[model samples]
Target: MRQPREKIFITCAVTGNLTKPEQTPYLPITPQQIADASLEAADAGAAIVHIHVRDPHTGNPSMELDYYRDAVEQIRGKNRDLILNLTTGPGGRFVPSHDNPRIAGPGTTLIAPERRVEHIAALKPDICTLDLNTMNSGGEVVINTPQNIRRMAKIIRESGVKPEIELFDSGDIALMHALLDDGTLQGPVLCSLVTGVRYGFQPSPETVIYARNLLPPNTEFTAIGVGRASFTMVAHSYLAGGHVRVGLEDAVYLSRGQLAKSNAAMVEKAKRIVEDLGGQIATPLETRDIIGLPQPAR
Candidate 1:
């Protein structure tokens, strides 16, 4: 039986690669905006911030080293204790051409695995996401073969950053166990069970318990609800012995027909939900201790 988490930590995913600029006027775009949004979320009781940079002018996802550096530096300057979890999920989406499916399509961003983690090596944040799902994502397919995953894992490990395995389905959890057995990923790992994405894990209580049961012993997991199910999973995740995550990356609306003004607003709501369930929100310093992350030297 999965026990409830008395003390939980909320991770605010400030910006994501898939969320479009036109989705909401308040989504953070530039490095400064991203940093400011992260700080605001932390102030709203989010212990960690999951970040993905965007091109300031184009508002598209960017893997540029400078963009990451600028966003990371700005956040570190203001808040030293807020855990930073950067994304290496870009450079893996494959949009196959209609004429020749093997040929890359316009939206395909596939690249050498090392190139994907270049930013991770350059800027070693406290944590970075290592996606393991190779499922269909809308019109495109995400390709994360075991070989490529190992290559990227090597770089993330070498950088001294923890990889929060993003598991979209039960098979991904199996892959996680394989990596642990081979020593590619260490044990007592940290991961996120992302739910509510179409063609991925469905958002439901049964789905949460099934996936949570598959994880290895003592593994720290967060049950993330994307889209409309975002806040609902905050309570679900907490009751299932896991953490919770929410932000513009997951959902834009605070309620039906009402758009969230900022990432801070979403965090504030998630904080309220967890507390109403008799759960305590962990601070960044406390989160580090709970997750076994050491504070970085100043």
Candidate 2:
């Protein structure tokens, strides 16, 4: 098994799908805002930038292929070296009707695995996320059935974009192993252990360490502690031989009761924390090599 490296990598999840301008004014809505934020985060020492676009008019999460194309092209036009990770987490939201069990009610966003990954095939970001379980999240069911996961994994593999397997709880380790064993996903897996969502794993450093310990040998992991737990989990993940992620996607605050003004602010804070711990921030080139992605042609 390959060992964890000394250099710490920071992924800035710039402008997630859910937050709105009211919730945090820093939330980037239009393609230009998203692109500019990504570049700014990269400049602030983020090795990877994870993106999810929103409708410019409504500020709602959007899966429109053109939105992704515009944002991706704009980011790439300026920065060739950063690792880009677009999210596939949008179409999996399912809020079943309390009145009728059979009825897939309002807020149901489930789509075919092929449709969920269409942007990836077209734009081909260096990485994308694959949520690993069907679970209760934010009072809704995030339905990523094993069959759906395998189908998505297959598509991601075919597209040559690495999948960041997102794990929210410990039970998912078995499913992760199954995916690995069955070749649904390839070796040296990239995982993001997410905690502190409404009903997933609790946001605790112990939970972070436990989840990190469960991955297969040589697996690369990003520890995400949603909301208030974000910074603590990032610190725990780094200390436990894993990577760290921070941004408005997981957190809105730069500190207690302080809303972060920009994605760059979050990245800068993560950079300080990582460096203060005596680890150097990994460069974009180092990040791709660490995850086995080929460097772009010079």
Candidate 3:
């Protein structure tokens, strides 16, 4: 008899930080909306929900502890078993003044390294993103120096929360390894290959394969293709023995002109695709076990 195929972890990025509702009407902003979207995704076979809280009033990205707390509480109240992966990738954007570069502009929000992961450390989510490299992120500069990453990694490790190292480009794989070598990150490091962003790695099968090859042995990883590359990359990642992430945080449309009503819809589509390809979807408990997340409290 043939052996059964391994079940793949399905992570849903419920709401991205920067993308506004103007881009897509389906984006979830308020705490209740986030919680509702996450619950739906969990029902649709997503083992984990990768979250980013937005300003309740303005719909802008926010790192406020209150927002994170409210969102986490709401989701946990409903789905106790769903894994929540909070984001620490905020507080690092730098957009200099065009005329006078000396003074920082309004777009700059660079905070101290310790402040970056403050929410995650306090909330104690199952996982939090640890963006390892500094890069020109689209029109803005996402400054993540080696020193800051070390400091942030130390905090994340000490907090007992797994860090989902985000690699926007191939070079970040090397930086991730360095974090592991310096004892800042522990074993079974989880990675996310982000593609189709303005200045990050472009979405392509070859690029995904190349990036995956560079990861350390025994690493668990996933792939996210932003915007138009979403579905294609999901299919590619599944084929390459990696996990998948989908939802409004990555792509808002079901097709070129169609809008996704919720994160659950996106997960449903991914589930269909994965099943058609002979793969099984992972449950929240299985995902927690795979990623070494702390079990839900009784």
Clashes of each: 0, 0, 0
- Ranking 1 against 2 by lDDT, winner: 1
TM-score of 1: 0.99
Candidate 2 clash pair list: none
Query: Candidate 3's residue-wise lDDT over 1-298, tens digit each?
Result: 1122388888999998877889888899998899899999999999999999999899999888998899999998888899999999998888899898876788898999999988978989888998976888867889898899989888887888888999999778887777778787787879999999877889998888888888887778887899989989888888888889998988889888999888999999998888889999989988888777767888
lDDT of 2: 0.88
Q: What TM-score, computed on C-alpha atoms, does each candidate reach?
A: 0.99, 0.97, 0.96
Global lDDT scores for all candidate models? 0.94, 0.88, 0.87
Best by lDDT, which number?
A: 1
Q: Please list the residue runs of candidate 2 whose C-alpha ends up more than 4 Å from where it truly belongs after superposition.
A: 1-5
**How big is the positional error of residue 280 in model 1, measured in Å on the Cα after superposition?**
0.1
Q: Write the per-residue lDDT of candidate 2 for residues 1-298, one digit (tens) a residue.
A: 2233489789999888766678888898999999999999999999999999988899889999999999999989989999999999989988889999678889999899899999999999999999887888777888889998988888888999999988988888889999889889888989898888887888776786678778898888988888888888877778878899999988899999999999999999998887888778999999998999999878
lDDT of 3 at 80: 87
Candidate 1: Cα lDDT at 272: 93
- For model 1, give the RMSD to the true fold: 0.7
- lDDT of each residue in 273-293, candidate 1, tens digit only: 989989999999999998889
